[model samples]
Target: MQLVVGRIGRPHGLRGDVSVEVRTDEPEKRFVAGAAVATDPASAGPLLIESLRWHSGTLLVRFEGVNDRNRAEELRGTMLVIDSADIPPSEDPDEFHDHQLIGLAVLTPDGERVGEVSDVLHQGQDLLVVRRGKTDVYVPFVKALVPIVDLDKGILVVDGPAGLLDPDAIV
Candidate 1:
């Protein structure tokens, strides 16, 4: 399984260096010299990292064969992905990979089934995308909202606020 690690941003300079919008926490391990990562569109590349450096807190990478600014610009917005098998397990118990959360059943504190986790969005806040019927509900993945993650039981308990799970219900 391919997991997205980062997205190629704008070209940095006259050379084929592009800034990266990193999605993974282990950027140092994932983005390094001579690392080859797969691309999203499939046509862009299995880009080989010729070199990488941090420029003012931003990760800048130059891929092999991409020697000019135009070549780097062409790779803009390309998602850099690695095999899921390549990811090392987190030592922290609280840390859960997106793959680990994806198929887990979501339930209320009372054990009423709400949905199944379809995705986890990592924006400014982490949001769990729970699929209920044909629709998807975005639930904030915080301790107050999601108190329990019973991975062994394949379920997670949601301690949602009023009208959070059901909009039609009176607040």
Candidate 2:
């Protein structure tokens, strides 16, 4: 299993530094200097991380053999990935990998089946994409909304507000 850790954004400066949109929670562990991460396009890398720094809260990365802005720009939109086997299991019970959450049954507080977790989106806010028949409900993955995650039972309970899970409900 390959897990995406980040995406290469536009070139940061004249050097080979490129802005990275981090996808993983542990950026320091995954985006270390001298680490080699595989790329989605396959041709772009195995990119060796020469160095990394935080610039105004954005993660900036420089790859080995990439010495100029033009070279860095070439890596734009490239998905940085690593083998899932490299990731250790989290000690926190509340923490979950996207793979673990996906395919789990989604239910309401009263035990009504809502859907199945099709995907986990990690934008500004984490969202679980629950597939309910023809509709895909975007449930905010918060303690208030998703209070239960019974991995042993392969089910998660969503305590969303009335219209939050109902796609057909008129706003």
Candidate 3:
């Protein structure tokens, strides 16, 4: 259960420093020195954080053994991950990770099976993209439209209007 935390950017200065686009909400608390994080597309080994700090709302990190501009440049665009077991528990029941909803089934309020959630898009608004046979539908994740999300049953009950799945319907 590895979760992505950040993405490494290009070298910032000559002191083996690289910018990171923090994806986690608590970046400062998560990217502490000596903490271990996995980097991708190399997923076999984990990178140890030697130092970390905030810079312009982004994270600046220096990893052990990567002490030069060239070394840091090579890690650009790599994603940082941590074991999901290390993630602190959340009190909010609705705050589910994107990975948890990837394969859940979607149904209408009337108990009609709609489709399976193929992907969760996080743009300006969160969207649950469903795939039904050959048809793909995008459903907004607003409470008014999605009233029930039964994770235990592996299904989400939506309350959208008629023709919401039609190609011409407003997304």
lDDT of 1 at 42: 82
What lDDT score belongs to each candidate, Candidate 1 first? 0.89, 0.91, 0.81
For residues 85-117, write the lDDT of model 3, one tens digit per residue: 776656888776666777898888888887898
TM-score to true structure, per model: 0.81, 0.85, 0.77
RMSD values, in order shown: 2.7, 2.2, 2.9
Highest TM-score model number: 2
lDDT, model 2: 0.91
Query: Which regions in candidate 3 have their CA more than 4 angstroms from the true location?
Result: 26-29, 42-44, 121-125, 131-138, 162-164
Q: What count of clashes does model 1 give? A: 0
Q: Please give me the total number of clashing residue pairs in predicted model 2.
A: 0
Better of 1 and 2 by lDDT: 2
Model 1: lDDT equals: 0.89
**In candidate 2, what are the lDDT values of residues 39-69, reduced to their tens digit?**
9988999999999999999999999999999
